[model samples]
Target: MKWTIYQLLVMIGVTFFMWGMENINNENLIAQPPGEWTAVNSPLLTFLATGLLITGFYFIFLFEVKKKKNRFQHPVWIYMPQLCMAIGGVSFVLFLIGGTIGPLGGWVEQMRSLLYLILAYFLFLIFLFIFSFEHKRNRSAQATEKTIHLTFFWTLMLFFGLFFLF
Candidate 1:
């Protein structure tokens, strides 16, 4: 993929923005004892960090994925694991959110504790549905003829659906 000056500048700006958000999140470490400002627990900083990271990903997607023909760009087994890390990062954030909010109340609040699991199941379902649809549509962007088997994929989806619904 070709990089441009604009993209580079945007990237640099995002990096700085993320760093500043981190400092905001960890302002306690920046502040010292004796008449100094300490960290304030601001929800805004966390939200801004979330927004910036997502914006960065979308920026990358527009330049890298959407612009390319056959956006898969690599074989599933080779590429998916790396993409999983990004997915995992989001999951971790959701986990943190759920964990933090889970203790605020009782049984209804208990749902917060399982938020990640619930989300993961839906995410898996949607991902599989898209994959299956793409396969049926012959949208396999891979160079080779082989792709992930639909049977195994659907089986996983079925399990998640059963667990989620029943």
Candidate 2:
């Protein structure tokens, strides 16, 4: 049998999805046990599951980039990190509130969620830079190629970025 990078990546993604799904109902996977001093077991599990799912999504993004043969140069990829940032934010919030006693336990889960949130922010920032660079290149090409119109979203983002510098 022959396999390509895409196939391998897809398989890895499937594996992550499966594990995440399995963990969704597995209470034992949490570091803390039920009726324990730490009330963060659920939150920790939620964060772990979210991470696994996002990792799978990332592999899907890689698979798309590789299959398209753009060398991952397309500006559209900026959305992946943006989505990840959103996901990570949600996970952090869940980790924060998943416990019955929010003010009491789950310090470690909070820290882990904070780490994931920070990583997501970094990834989003990096993709923003990449998108800016690619946008300039594409804009230059559009200038020389005589494109009549840009999508409404593109036009909106351009004006917004000009105003906000984001």
Candidate 3:
């Protein structure tokens, strides 16, 4: 049997999806008493599931990019969108599906919070877009540095978001 990175990534994605589904459904493969803390009901599990799914699809897109023999001079820039998408998408999903049930336990409260989170995420997207566009236009060291800075900024945002969410 032949294996490729794509296949491996897909399998890992599928595994993550299955586990996430089980977690969401509150079904544990392990035997435990009913009133216990399981990862099933956690918001972080939902976030992880959403992020992993995005990552899988991104890898498939990368496979297509490679298939066309289009090489990136700055691979980090290419990955920035994936990171942005994963975080933004997860935030949206968490708000939509698990919002009221999460830390903020009311629809109105969650919606208000969502508004701010969305606005911040949108701002980050805009900055990323501008940096990427400028980098492509000028291919300058400064532009590249700004894009890398944005990536790090996004990662830091991810950690803070998780901390607050959890």
Candidate 4:
């Protein structure tokens, strides 16, 4: 599919909106060190990164789908994000285990924060995968099935993540 500049811009805007909401929640505030200026964490960064990932995959999947091609010979550059996603998932689980079973107090608190960040990364990857898959599939016939799968996956992940967060 040919993507117009307008479509890309719209996707960027949507990504920024989603990322901003995720990163800038007031409830998760952390205090800065004395005499240090607090930096604003824009969730927009996460959104933009995620959006780019989804856009790339969408373009690849669209090209393949439109051409009716199913060759699985993905190049190294195409697989890099998937590798990063796997690393992020493993790191998240490790952080959760280390935080819960390894220590107490400050160390655990720090680990918990790190775990949350990793969870956010994992969620972003999940969104990228789902959005790409949905864009590739026959929307009318498989929409419900795909939605159910994504909902279940996200629900399970969010439940476990929240359990670790609090």
Candidate 5:
């Protein structure tokens, strides 16, 4: 994909925004010690992070569908895995990066928690239904969907596993 100055700026802005949000403390209503400012227990952060994730993925989904000439008429189930995988993979990377060298260091313990399992389940269902879709003779649509689905799954899995090695 071609990178434009505007897109790069927006991404940088989002990264900073996420970093700022991750550092917000909803408890105590006051500042903590210099090194204790990380607030991994804030529910607001969790909800905000989830909302941002969904919104980002929604825009990406729309762009992908429009770019690839795919319609939104596909069953909702066909999209769930793709959605969850995108969200989960993004969340994992953000948290992983933040925990390693940013404010989310406090979230390291929760990094590989139950959410990953749930995402994995959705990913599994995506593969299972990949072969079950009745695309009939619309080979292009079938190929497109299959390509998108497999690409998302494998790419996420590969990077996720790689990140855990260090």
Candidate 6:
């Protein structure tokens, strides 16, 4: 079954939704009391998770652009997702740096929260990107696209949820 670009985009959108939901829930869990939930105390793990999430989104953007035959040139807004990913990555790195320096508790936590919010915006961009890219597509490809989209979405959410929640 040949897949239309729209079908692929829908799959991506569904993925973003699923991932965002998981992320929100996970973040909530992490914000809970320390004794009740085993928070990730290791800075290395925090940094790694943030880096990987940013990297994964970046790859997704690159792959979509390449797959679309450079059609991304149409509008300037199309690049927003990649930009958000970059911002999140930078913010996370800054949080890591601040955390290591000591006496920067306020700065580190602020940076971390900012990064999380930006990551949420990135998910919105992902949704838009998929919608814009999938204006016209065949139905036959929808099933496969849906499966992959859901898989990636849930996987990302689970990974981030685990990292953020406990």
For 1-166, candidate 2 gives per-residue lDDT tens digits of 1225665766666565555544543545545554668544465454554444444444544444345354345555446445546666685686557545574256535454444444445444433343344444565565311211232234334434544452
Q: Can you write out model 4's per-residue Cα lDDT over 1-166, one digit (the tens) per residue?
A: 2434444655566456545554654356644457756444433443454444444434433444334233422344345446656766786676677657765336636544443344455655665455444334534556433543553455445545654574
For candidate 6, write residues 1-166 as lDDT tens digits.
1224544665576456546645665576445555665544454545464545544554454455445354444554445446656666776676567657754577536545544545545554444444333422322445324533553555456556766675
lDDT of 5 at 113: 37
User: Global lDDT for candidate 6?
Assistant: 0.50
Candidates' TM-scores?
0.37, 0.30, 0.34, 0.30, 0.32, 0.29
lDDT of 4: 0.49
C-alpha RMSD of each candidate structure in angstroms: 13.4, 13.3, 9.9, 10.2, 12.4, 11.4
Minimum summed lDDT over a 10-residue window in model 6 is located at 131-140
lDDT of 5: 0.46
Candidate 3 accuracy as lDDT: 0.52
- Give every collision pair in model 1: none
Candidate 2 residues lying further than 4 Å off, grouped into runs, are: 1-20, 23-41, 68-166
Which portions of model 4 miss their true places by more than 4 Å?
1-41, 71-166
TM-score comparison, 2 vs 5, better candidate: 5
Model 5 Cα lDDT, one tens digit per residue, 108-146: 355533333344344344432332232322435565555
TM-score of 1: 0.37
Q: Per-residue lDDT for 1-166 in model 1, tens only? A: 3644545766787667645644553454533457755454443443444445444533543444334464445456344544655666686676567557754235325444243234434444444344444444554454212333442344445544654574
Candidate 5 pairs with clashing backbones: none
Displacement of the residue 143 alpha carbon in candidate 4, Å: 9.9
Off by over 4 Å in 6: 1-40, 75-166
lDDT of each: 0.47, 0.46, 0.52, 0.49, 0.46, 0.50
